[model samples]
Target chain A: MKKKRALALLLTTVMGLGLLTGCGGSGSSSESADSKDAEEGKTLSMMCIGTTADAYMEGYQSIIDSFNENNEFGVTVDAEFVSNSDYKTKLTTLMASDSEPDIIFTWELGYLQTFVDGGKIVDLTPYLEEDTAWKDSFNDGMLDQLTYDGKVYGIPTQECVGTMYYNKAIFEENGVAVPTTYEEYRQVCDTLVANGVTPVALASTPDDAWLVSQYIQQLANGIGGYEYFESLKDGTGKWNDDTMVQAAKLFQEEVEAGYYEDGFTGVSGTEAEALFQSGQTAMYYNGSWETSNLDNSEYCEVSEDVSCFTMPAVDAENAYISMGSVDSSYAVSTNCKNVDAAVGLLKYWTNAENASMLLYDYGRMPSTKVELDQSKLSSLCIDVIARFEEQKSLTPWFDRVDTNIGNEFNNCGVSISNGEDPQGIYDGLQEYAQSQS
Target chain B: MKSVFGNKKSIAVFVLPAFIVYAIFCLFPIGYNIYMSFFDTNLMEKSTFVGLNNYIQLAKDATFIKSLKNNILMVIGSLIAHMPLAMFFANAIFKKIKGAAFFQTVFFLPSVICGVAVGLTWTFIYNGNYGLLNAFLGAIGLENLQQVWLSNKNLALFCIIIVVMWQFVGYHMIIQLAAMRNIDSSYYEAASIDGATGWQQFVNITLPMIKPILKIDAVLIITGSLKYFDLIAVMTGGGPNHATEVMSTYMYYQGFNILKYGYSSAIGVVLLLLCAGSVVLSNKVFKTDDTQM
Candidate 1:
């Protein structure tokens, strides 16, 4: 009896150990999750818009290292770049779940409105008011886009405008001169087509429909102004108005004219960009954010020969306004346990030294109004920034301004590209916008 | 009392762990998902009690209706590939042809590969720029027939379905082959002595003998395709404007992308009901008497 009892006790102990080990598995996953929060002795996590594959991450990391070595707050900053397309989804998910990183890169207007409404973002008005130097550090009217209900929600990191980046080498080789007027732009494309080179590389894939729509929106803004879109959003103006219809018809004309590549209706943004970078296409209409891509020697063959010009106005009288906005500005999340540290990092990042480091290394335009020494700036970047500053007025990008109907509007662009009637596309978008309200 | 799982109680105790595990991990989530279908929820926010608004909304949603039609077509495709075609292959192998084992392995190899890998390989094979399909068509002087296989909205779902069929026809063939091997050799021997043709032996004997196993296979295939997720998720993500949205992918999109958790739960409920109904329908179609065996 004693031996049997002893054997039973031994088996029970073994079983107990097995159960204990099985229960321990859950503890390890939780530990790794918490380690993300605990690892920051002085490190602040700044979520930005770029993927690991993007060349811009290496440039951003150097700035982070510089900040770690020298900062008033004695905190090291690290940037985690979520891809541009996935960034908004990740931010909304993280914000709703109360797991947002310390500082978030955000778009302006209604794109950031949801976070403000949900009380998930910190009001930066008091911070701006206290630091007059930092407040004055931004260019005129830059802060207005980031403010909501008379309170600031984010800091504009870089002012961006969409422009037609042309291949100077290709144009010079083909003996085609750059266009100065809207009519001249069309004539240049006509000449390029006669010479057998694709004039513009436009991607019409569903994911990149925004690229085409942005060009249209820019054309519309050049024809009208911000008020036209605002009126449309507020139900005062219709998308099927004469101005929009004209823009759509012009896009279709360009498509039929063989100005874009043969199979561009299904081509993706990267593919179009690749064609442009390979110098097969003379022009690529994209944002200033793509400046880094154009400058990267590994990706762009004509890096040195690429230059930018504002997309010409449909009406010569209107100041040439292109789709411009604050590119991926920074905001502090309400869920951040250490807001002061996050704000400090944001301030450090936008300051002259780190901003210039980012500019020189990554070709990023500075958000702060500090003057860049011409000697240090790339000639192409300098020229682009000069044009960006010269604009009398900057209309915020169409998609960011109208978050609720933006993606649907982009989809309409795709449908139109794929041979759907423009009127039908606009009608569908109009109905969707109505449903949202 | 002795007949009440006597001498097998320890075995039962050993199996208790697995039984409890299966019940907790599998059954509970399905039950909870059904319960969630009645409410309107966003997962992170407060869920409202909306008796059947989600269901009502689902019925009216055009995207959901289109997805339902696509899923029905997918079911027919799966049934044709796994049932009749697989049976044909199984029957051919059962006749002890030369290199039957080699062909069996060749057929079963695709089923063993991960779905995501198969999807990626096929995506390349269907690519427009330098794909094998385009090259083959071009070589045959049929260039006009070539297409961007996975991009066109009308062709994307069919492309995915063909890949699905190619990937799993072998698995079902193996299942039917197992059932075929179980049939007594005496039956075929007796049929041969009676001057019955080979087709007659197969139609009269092999099929009826494998009816019960085929019922199980039908249930497996139907449920498997009903809740399919990974291949479509990796290949297209139901895009070129939700053209390939299946019930599972749609449920994921609503839950994750749009944050419509309550609506997603409603989709989950419908998927469960469809799967359950297919099982019952298959059993009725393949009705069998245990005493016949």
Candidate 2:
């Protein structure tokens, strides 16, 4: 019995030591491995949004691989890809922990502004100012969204605008032409519904609230124009503004009119996209980033017949005004050991050759000027590019403008989709906005 | 060795490691969270002391209030399903019913699955379009009854609660069954000889004997429901305009999504208090003394 007690005591001590060693070993080994990598050469870590589901992931990987192989600075990059849905939470957690990757994929405006406020991002203004040609390469105002307090914090890689993608075969079968006016858009929906087809495929799940909210913003853009969007951004406009109310009412009307697929409020983004791809819905309104997905034969049964046009203007005078913003921007984190190498890698990524490749092959619209080879682009990409060029103004999504108000707007959008009273919803949002200010 | 067992120093040696770990990972976080509840911060930036403002705001915050109500409903729903219903199944199984082992495994299987996996399976089953529930309804000529289970704000929380009930009823049943098995068979045999019906035997011999375990199971069900997160997070994500938002998910939304860490911490403190309160309340309700066992 005494021996058994001694054995048990010995086991307990061993277990305690094992736990202590387990904790200490992991920390020390990782530190050593990082130092070893640093001594070999600068190793920049990049985290971007890309997963197997995204068509352009290959293009993104190729850019990283090429940069790693050919950079003149002897810097190597280790990249990690997270799916878009999980990117924001993952990035924010990393930022909070001060272990953010050297380079991070970021959205413009308020999303990046939070990190800037936290002093977690590297200021890229000096780098941009030092290279006049590179600065000039980006279109005017492209960098403005990422500029905070006169310092640029990110490099914009692509420009995106929302467009209404439709199945040509479905439209033709129903004898409906692409709508060019707000009235025509409603009529088109009516016609589709009368023909026993779902008019639009939309996802309204809480996780995909932005998918529905962006379309509502597009409608608001048509009704209130870019000026209204700007006023909302600067706090001069109320969420309950007449045009905003009209936009919400119209969206609700559309939802009630069976303009959207059945039970769309529960549908996930991918599921809604699949519904349209499978030829069950006539239209899908989303960012041009979806061009590759819509046109990919592997994912879409209607890929060959997929085409797009901008949603028609609510007021014809404000025609071509759309909801859009800079997409796929990269920012250097303050945690980066080699800022220059990271910036150089970003520059290489947005260079003319890679920009053209991304645009032609993956349907990413380059923020920088690149010669378009029309022959190499999908027809949908060409149409989207043409629409981008024709846009009178593009308003960014509300969530990108201000995280607090934008999130409220998205929640309101979900409620609106579920047949809630728009006046009550907007009143609550307006009250919250005022309270925040 | 006997002296070592009686010695406080040896006992401390055995307990200190686990106690230290618990303090670091659990107690410290709880204390830090309470301290954080008094500040307005994103945690990365310097925090401003906000006193009781976060708690005050939580009271007025419509979504938070809704979540509190949802959480209460969840607790009630869980209690109703896990107690009497579980006891009924446990008693049935304890009588050596036919196919007892098969039924036992069938009932307990869901609780063994990961919460996220169960949530995902139920999500597919409750899907609005191609979901099994709707398809089944349609096949029965009740197509009009079909509605998006997770999207209908009125039905969404109840649907999730049903899944939670389905997932854990068997688990509670197993707990109650174990307690039933611990009861002396001689008591039941004596009651039978005294001409007591099965119901009488259950009330006199079974329930009183198992009261101590029931007290534990009650606390588990109540506290478990109060702190529920994974299934709700994986299912609706407090969707359809925050109709399904629970306190835990709201805390996550505030802290992670909106970067309101202080406010999230306040929510955390409230949840912690509520969970602790439920345990106390359950203990009082059960009132089974240790000596009774």
* Per-prediction CA RMSD (Å): 6.7, 4.4
Report, for every candidate in turn, its global Cα lDDT versus the true structure.
Answer: 0.77, 0.87
Tell me the DockQ of each model, to 2 decimals: 0.16, 0.39
Question: Could you give candidate 1's per-residue lDDT for residues B1-293 as a string of tens digits?
Answer: 55665668867986899779756655666677778888876554467899898899899776688888888888989999999999998888988888899989999899889878998788778777777888999999999988777767788899999988989899889878877877778999999999899989998999898888788789878877887777887776676566788988888667655556678889988987898899899999999987766
Docking outcome class, model 2: acceptable
Predicted candidate 1 versus true structure: per-residue lDDT over A126-180, tens digit per residue: 8889888998998888888888899999998887888799999888978877777
For candidate 1, the per-residue lDDT at B149 reads 75
Task: State the displacement of the C-alpha of residue B218, model 2, in Å, after optimal TM-score superposition.
Answer: 1.5
lDDT of 1: 0.77
What is the total number of backbone clashes in candidate 1?
0
TM-score of each: 0.88, 0.94
Q: Distance from true position, residue B200, model 2, in Å? A: 1.8
